[model samples]
Target: MAEKIKLACIIDDDPIFVFGTKKMMQYTGFCDTFLIFKNGKEALDHLSVILIEKKPIPDIIFLDINMPVMDGWQFLEEITKIDISETLKIFLVTSSETQEDRDKAKKFSAIKNYVVKPITLESLQELLPTI
Candidate 1:
């Protein structure tokens, strides 16, 4: 079996995507636990508190680009301000297929990679090894 991730997070507003991704992560044994947030603001708020408490943050975060109340770009900006652990890996999970978005994602050194959504099992399988 693949080594399990200690914790993973999903920051997306779409319930369907979140449900499917969570189910797939469970099936694949991707992570032992999950932290889910509907938007970047909620995620940032919780993560900020976690940071302050010096708790273990998510090992990986699957972030969406377009969300209400602070989008992914804003979250990335805010997260950089926080003194987060270096081990945190964030993957941009969005429906955008445009090259512009991909280029923009590259600007952030914190971002590990960008995966176009509806995340597939094969994609997750591939992603697990990298993380």
Candidate 2:
């Protein structure tokens, strides 16, 4: 049997980006159950409740850096303190290509990778084997 592959989540402020990522996930067969939130605060809050309820954490999450409330960096700080570390893979999905952003993402080792905007099939390919 094929291994279960779930497209766990995407936390971004841009709807277009979310739509594109969803389409890419569909094309690549890289994800199944996708949970999307408009900002990192909402994502982290919801996930925290799930964690408390003993819910299965998402296998992978695509998080955006810039937002109105609780930016990705703040969210990362909170999520890392949660008890569900082993069950989650967090990826920073940002439009910024700045080395500062990359370096900031590196500060949190929990982040699986830093993905540039407009996710592509080629980019998705790098993540499939791991999932």
Candidate 3:
């Protein structure tokens, strides 16, 4: 068996996507545990508390670009200010296929990759080795 991920988070407003991703991750044994947030603000609030308390943060974060009350880009910006672990990996999971978005994601060193929506099992398999 492959090594399990300690924790993984999905920060997106779409309940459907979250549900599906959670289920898929479970099926693939991609992670040992999971965290979820409706939007960037909600995620940031929890993240701030966790950081202040010196709690263990998620090992990976799958962020969506489109949402209300701060998008994925905003979350990325805010996280840069917080003291997060260097091993933490963030992947921009978005529906947008624009070159601009990919270029923008590159600016954030924490962002390991950009994945298009309807994430596949194969993609997760490939990602596990790197993380």
Whole-model lDDT values for every prediction: 0.90, 0.81, 0.86
The deviation in Å at residue 17 for candidate 3 is: 1.0
**Residue 55, model 2: Cα distance from true site in angstroms:** 1.1
Better candidate number, 1 or 2, judged by TM-score: 1
Model 2 — TM-score against the truth?
A: 0.89
- State model 1's lDDT: 0.90
Provide TM-scores for the models: 0.94, 0.89, 0.93
lDDT per residue (tens digit) for residues 39-126 in model 2: 8889988999988788777878888999878888889899888876356678888889999999888888778888888778777777
What does candidate 1's lDDT look like per residue over 10-65, in tens digits?
A: 99999999999999989988775899999999999999898878888888899999
Q: After superposing candidate 3, which stretches have Cα over 4 Å from the reference?
A: none
Residue 25 displacement in candidate 3 (angstroms): 0.8
**Stronger candidate by TM-score (2 vs 3):** 3
Runs of candidate 1 with Cα error greater than 4 angstroms are none
